[model samples]
Target: MKAFTDLEVWQRSRVLRNDISQLTKSFPSEEKYRLSDQIIRSSRSVGNNIAEGHGRFHYIDSSRFLITARGSLIETLDHLIVALDEKYITEEIFNKFKGDYETCLRMLNGYITYLRNQQPQKNG
Candidate 1:
């Protein structure tokens, strides 16, 4: 298999990071180091963990990291929701970001399932 960098999930996550960064630009200045930073860091973590996990030698190890990445993705969505409710994002922007997050979630879940299915059978 190719490296994690070559994986679609990683690539998509990279795109998500850029999208989130752009979206956060309109956030209130007071959130410069608060909500904005948290969202950006959490979004990047999703991709970073996926890449790091791919470099690991064991399937279980990789799966664990991907799971962590998934958690980060959810956290990002929560932050997005807050931003929307606070009027930091319009309905259109919220829809756009929500779509991307849902897509990423699907991709992550698929990757996890793929990894689980690839594990070698263990002796009883």
Candidate 2:
């Protein structure tokens, strides 16, 4: 992959973010300031954090950001659960989104492990 955009986790997170954005529009107006806002923020944070981590000069820093991204993914899942409980979304849709987010989480975890296992460059 030539860029952060090429990373599978990043790409999937972007798609998930877009999916959540569109789904939120169907929520009641009252949710605009609550659950909808939360899911949107958390979903977008996943990709944003991943990209930020990719840009970091040190592998440790990248891993840190990846961890944060993973946290955001969890947060997004929490918001989804709330939506499901509130009857804002159907069981089928919730399951699908949750499954996709879980996949992204697994991929992000693998990426983090890879980064942590890498040896730092030695000074010349």
Candidate 3:
């Protein structure tokens, strides 16, 4: 990969971030600084971490950031759950976003595994 944007996981995350941002815009102003902000931040974090990870160059270093990105993906999903509970979104919307989250999760996991396999074996 020449750039972080080239990663499929990063691309999926970007889509999720945009979707979350658009969804939050319909939320009541009362949640402007609360759940709305939380979801947006978490969604954005996924892509941010992926990019940062790719920039690290080393397998272990990149893996650390990828792990963080995975956490952010889970966090974003939790936020979506909260949105569903609060009726800010319908079941259909929630499911769609959930699918998007899962795709990113899978892609991220696959990338991490690929990185690990590509790492050089160390001899004592």
Candidate 4:
């Protein structure tokens, strides 16, 4: 109905970026330029892409950007899983951030579905 910034997905993504920044601080120094950096970059991409898409003039373009944002979110989650497996994070921390990631994913998917259903048909 409104712009992507006004969407719950964007808001949640902003919060997610902040949370990922904080969480990455607890990672081992060896990962400072590796997983930690990647996690932060990927997390930020989610919000950035949404904002960029919101500024686009077409719904299809916006939807495409949101899809890219969702892909980045998935990438970040994969890095989180690796951090957990490598002992960079404890189960408690993993559970907390993992929950947020899952919520973001669900919201992104819902928005994508909504966008697709709203598109008008072409006469071909």
Candidate 5:
């Protein structure tokens, strides 16, 4: 990939981040400092970590960042569950976002596994 933006994981994450931003707008003001803030930050971190990983030269380094990104994605999912419990979002909306997040997680895992399978050549 030429850049992190070229990665399917990053692209999907960017879309989800935007989606969460828009969805959170309907949340009550009380959540503005709590759930809303947390979900937004976690969502943004997913893409940020992917971009950072892409910038790394070593495959291992990149994979490590991707792992971190996956963690952030999971965090975002937890926030979604909380939102659902709080009635900030309906089950349908939560399910949709959950599906998207799960897809991103799987893609990231596949990419990380691919990276791990690579063997760096040593110059003789």
Candidate 6:
């Protein structure tokens, strides 16, 4: 890709990050530095890591950052489940965000696979 922002996964993650920011605003004040902060940070990390990965010169280095990005995505999902259990969001809202998570995940995995293919073949 021309830039990290150009990656489909990064673009999709930006949408989710924005949505999570807005969603957390409705959370209880008590959660301002708790679950809300965690979810927001994790969501933001997804894009941050993806951008860092895209800037790497080596495919292996990029893959490592992408893996961390994927982990942050999963962490965001856990925060969503916590929100649901605490009645901070409706089941409908949870499902919507979950779908968005899956889309980013699929795209990220595909990108990782593409990068793997681009690696030089080993003589082993």
- Using lDDT, give the best candidate's number: 6
| Candidate 2 structure quality by residue, lDDT tens digits, 18-92 | 999999999999999999999999999999999999999888999999999999999999999999999999999
TM-score of each: 0.96, 0.94, 0.96, 0.92, 0.94, 0.98
Residue-level lDDT for 41 in candidate 3: 94
* lDDT string, candidate 6, 1-124, tens digits: 4988888899999999999999999999999999999999999999999999999999999999999999999999999999999999999999999999999999889988999999999896
Task: Summing lDDT over every window of 10 consecutive residues in candidate 2, give the lowest-scoring window.
Answer: 115-124
Per-residue C-alpha lDDT of model 1 across residues 9-66, encoded as one tens digit per residue? 9999999999999989989999999999999999999999999899899989999999
For model 4, residues 13-98, the per-residue Cα lDDT tens digits are: 99999999998898889999999999999999999998888788887998999999999999998998999999988899889888
Q: List RMSD in Å for every model shown.
A: 1.0, 2.7, 1.1, 1.6, 2.4, 0.8
Question: What's model 5's lDDT at 58?
Answer: 91
Candidate 2: the clashing residue pairs are none
lDDT (10s digit) by residue, model 5, range 30-87: 9999999999999999999999999998998999999999999999999999999999
Give the 10-residue window scoring lowest on summed lDDT in candidate 4: 1-10
Better of 2 and 3 by TM-score: 3
Q: Kindly report which residue stretches of model 5 are placed more than 4 angstroms away from their true locations once superposed.
A: 121-124
Q: How far off is residue 16 in model 5, in Å?
A: 0.6
User: Clashes in model 5: which pairs?
Assistant: none
Alpha-carbon RMSD, candidate 6: 0.8
The regions of model 3 sitting more than 4 angstroms off are none
